[model samples]
Target: MAHAESVRVVFVDAETEEEFARTELAPGQLPDSFEYETRLDLGGESWAVVRADPPSAAQFLRSGSLVLTLRRIQTVDPQEMAYSLPTIFDPLPPTEDSTGSGEHFVIHEDDWRQAELVSRQLAGQVEAEMRAIHEVFRQSSRVVGEGASSMRVFDRIHVRRTPIDPLSTEVSLRRLSELLPVGGRPYAGVRIGDDPGRVVDSFVIAADPLVVYGQALGDRVTVLCLAPLLDAATESAAGLEQAMREFDLVLADWCSGRLLDASAVGAFLNQA
Candidate 1:
């Protein structure tokens, strides 16, 4: 198992809703760790986005709307920090020399079984939910710089459906960009097709947190989140893997809308 600097799980709405706000939400629905919070006015109504700062954990929950994120950051020395930091000038390097930097994972049959266990714990069950399925994987590596310092890089690939199609990939990628918070230099290119369906083609590059690529199918969308490892490293690779797996388990629940269940959420909030 490889060590992870941090693990982040996010849920995004396919379309923006006008009526989301923090004021309308009950504080009990949010995690207690969320001490610092703020709201943004999109259109005339107030759309609330709250954040809480806890050691090693961070959450950004947008109320009445479509985005929620859970992040675990790894704190490292300046030299180690180089391994995961993202710079505006540098485009993502080709995956030739940094082979050992990361790993790839796919949601498997056993994973679905584990998710079913999580669903069983939920009290308020999901009534009607979208059947969209999302597959997420990560690639991590350390890149040496001009000096002795190195930056750690994390690349995530999220796919909705399989059987890659060229025309579909192109059109889906375009629509994915439309939903993001705009304002960045646009970059695109095609990667070799041998690794179809995955983010094996052209992508976008921007400052630190980059939305490398996004593709949609039917009502489901796939997006890539690439950035530096911003958390402290664990003592062992197994420990890191444990942390990642736990996050992935919850992620499966979130994708299934099981996380919206009141009882199920208690478990996620209680996790350290």
Candidate 2:
């Protein structure tokens, strides 16, 4: 597989021309066309990508360096906003069993709403816990106050589904096993569901602080995880150590499924 190249998108204010927000887009995530009215969610605010400087600069957004000028907007169309945002889930290919039975795995709109609610709740809880933990760390002189800004908790989650095969299973297991041991913790692991023999795999993705896991049943796969935006460049040695300790705590809960078990969304998915 070809390596995916990411583009750094810089969002600048239209009025003051000052940079307000920035984010990195994974390869294939950027839209082919940059519409003038395309609205983006930046730090919970809706900002429209008005235009690119020189107009021709828009073409570079997909392949090379990119800059976006955004104007704050009062209201956004739901459909337009949905199109502007990065896709949360990609359609899974039809499996042999699904194709043969003519019964495809369908995700309803309500399912997405439930998932988003769960994600928001989890993010809130995480932020609160981290703040409290940071306070303790500050008092103990383990980390500085600025270290708290190194990690960002996201209010949204990303879900992806793919075909489950022996090759994919082996690859997933191997990757999980290879995760560096943190604080002498056991190697990350996967779980199996007995009801229908679904494989439940969970782990943090390399290069990001995302806690990801999913369940695969009858060839239908659904992976759901929260994306915790990290500013690695801003991390100091003390900050990095503090962040790692925080991550270790969360990863342990995530791998054991206790993290999701405490959420209503988890209950819904479990029953579904």
Candidate 3:
């Protein structure tokens, strides 16, 4: 898995570009169409300026439906963008490690049967943790403002409980259509979790006789299941954590740009 591209994508509704620019983060530098202000180069990737075009005014009335759009007025010089098309993959046994990017997971180098067991167990844990988060947060509210004189920060934080299901019962190419939106298909293989079951909605990542799903439509949360094919792994539960570490070993290359183009894309495209 390659690190995300440095090329910035500008998003907008099917509306006037000038009108959109006024609402942007660095109104001085970026164009709503051709270029967007880079958070690293500039200051912030202002979330305020970039928002999902509301499906309808009514959606805003009931917590807006998030529909994002990316518009390009000019092509990003792939060179200038500094993103890699190369891909790195996790190998089997002795190499797997436990490295996660928060609520994210991946599984590598495990047999299909072991992958199944790993996926199911982690799914159960995620479900239970989600339940616990909701139990503590949902249906609870607090007095936001304290003093009358001082202006409050941002009122209150009302987090809604969005209960999600297992990203997948198992992994396969056919499932990419379901994971990504139409046109959101990924071109590479992505892995998550050190153990076998972290069924996250990411791209088809490459790593030893892998069992993977494709594309995420840019979802960053990595609460995914770790799963791989059957032939390479054994049915032994005793070495679960070790297998996960072996998989984790590949992250450095992935982060540094060794994992993007590793797997032959011919296999994936054929499935699509």
Candidate 4:
């Protein structure tokens, strides 16, 4: 594939600083198109989330600081036929900001920089531990949350098939199947406990390499490379910085189209 259709950086924490986030972060600074306030409460256990969508980018700031996700949707015209535009999932409920001036969410050439800055800023205001960082690629059939607990974070690659205009279900399935081998239940998916270098692992959640049934309108088979976080015991500034650096290595390999069976996936994505 040429590059990701869209990339998102997500920050996870152990605490829910709903009031503090709402009160301190300004909402007015964001673009008016993002709307003044949107409230969303998924009910028990789920953190209350809020969303702000500007022309250049989109943001998800949740209650209790469960997570904060920043995404930049890449644009591809209909003629391109590679990927869909983008989908913006709703954020948590709105908070009460004393300043009422929301933070300015901008997409830079380097997303890592923005991610690091957000992690640092959030850590300064709250006592929550920086649990994990997630990088999401959307509208991408070839690639792919949160918590402060002592769980190992996996850097994953997701490959899926989504319906774009003019491509019917039958046609989409046929087109995608041509790229990889289709198989029965036994060979439907494969998982390599240890990666090529024994540095990571790989898993195929669904076997759509050639063909399969029960595929949703927007989701087909997906293969993921789960990169484990080895040195994330600390949640301080130093810890976060180290994690970010390690993540960069994983992201770089994925982006370069060099992971397990990446060549096969890339060939599929390159098709018109």
Candidate 5:
């Protein structure tokens, strides 16, 4: 929890939910304990609003049972706060480091054994997703040009995957390589050919959260910003993977600009 108190909204059904809100009675802070469970219909066939002090719940009844969630207000230290915000300076260093030769996390044999088992499962998923992404580009039309010229800097580089052409892959690859993050990583993968240096980070199966920054050299690095959805993968890794593909197709395309010419948006419906 944050040093400053926060409230969590929750939903409960058919039972009185009890939570512990602190008894300190600070006007804007969270209580140590709380209890707010009652039947107040939210007026839908499946939803209800249950209020309990600072803790509120809105839930839905699915197939005759209430789906309940206790939203938690979490806290982060100063470092996480800084990193999350866009800054003009270099990111702060790691506050803590672990050699792991110490007390916690181990008993070694058990840990490694558990990891090895999970690795086997995830390995298959990684290969399958990569193959699918590659195949989509292989079958689709080649997307041309650097995204938006104004958004890129001389030092910034971009890597793109698009359809392979029968006569000239080199010309397209040359144009695409112009936008990669310079000196950050090499361009490493392409869908259509045996081009060298195609996989930028062969192991960068997912994007790191883009820290919006102005580099020391007076150039800008505008990243595609897929890092947030990448983290979302921990809860549902499959969702993370699917989102990455969809983002490339949807959000990313629109980021280039607009797909339709509009007068007031409705104007385009009767376009010639």
Candidate 6:
């Protein structure tokens, strides 16, 4: 087996591309594994490892060290975060068609199965959370419909609630699976509203608590909430339940027409 006397890991800001820190690991202290999005602790701060210049462990063994780029966890965007596990094969290069339009990359069956497992897990979590949220509205709301991924509730008003798994949607999954891959990390969340192109509210399970209010006119969607949901970190279902309890209150107000716009939702989240 190839081995290195020492390994030097350099950390850089993902956004600024500036080196923030570097560490040298003796052969005995070398990490068992290193991969994209792996979190490292440096100076009491969390950083996500993004890239390795030599690219592989074998290369590191031959070279003894490689450059690593990392982004501060706090500065990472939720949308850019890796939601899926890494796949075994790189996407095949696009091939030109007769008309010169390139063909889409094909996903491997194993990768598809991996992504499907993640999608199912996320769907289950969403359903479970929605059920819990539904209980809060039990007195005033009645169920109109229910499915594997969504539920419809009606009080004096109607709302469709669903778990938003961008990975499960045929369109989104096909497009994003190449980027996000399939992973155990939870990236799925819930949405409550009538349509994505209209007034809607959603919560995303991210590094931070994220609640968004959205409204759309034609093809343009406008976001209303500028505040994070409650001052609490909601990375798990338990944390989400607590946030949802608070959200139910705001949703109740929205259903009653007291809070009519995204600004109201933003105010409620900021206050809470």
All models: lDDT?
0.29, 0.37, 0.30, 0.24, 0.24, 0.39
Runs of candidate 6 with Cα error greater than 4 angstroms are 75-272
The TM-scores, one per candidate, come to 0.19, 0.24, 0.19, 0.16, 0.15, 0.30
Q: Which of the numbered candidates is closest to the native, going by highest lDDT?
A: 6
Give the range of the ten consecutive residues with the poorest summed lDDT in model 1.
Answer: 84-93
Clashing pairs in 2: none
The root-mean-square deviation over C-alpha atoms between each candidate and the true structure, in angstroms, is: 27.6, 21.6, 22.3, 25.6, 22.3, 19.6
Better of 2 and 5 by TM-score: 2
lDDT of 6 by residue, 98-170 (tens): 2222222222322211111112224454345444434435544443435774443433222223333312312
lDDT of 3 by residue, 1-272 (tens): 23222222234434344323322232223323322432222133323233444433333223412233433334466433421211122232222332454333244332211211123324344344334334333333223346874431211221212113223333333333233222222223443435533333344433334333333435432323224334423221113233323222111111111111113222222222
For all candidates, the clash counts are 20, 0, 43, 20, 26, 4
**lDDT score of residue 123 within candidate 3:** 39
By lDDT, is 1 or 5 better?
A: 1
**Model 2: lDDT of residue 220:** 30
Task: Return the lDDT, model 3, position 167.
Answer: 33
TM-score of 5: 0.15
**Model 2 spans with C-alpha error above 4 angstroms:** 1-4, 53-58, 61-63, 75-272
Clashes of 4: 20
- Largest TM-score belongs to which candidate? 6
Worst 10 residues of 2 by lDDT: 96-105
- TM-score of model 1 (CA atoms): 0.19
User: How displaced is residue 257 in candidate 6, in Å?
Assistant: 1.8
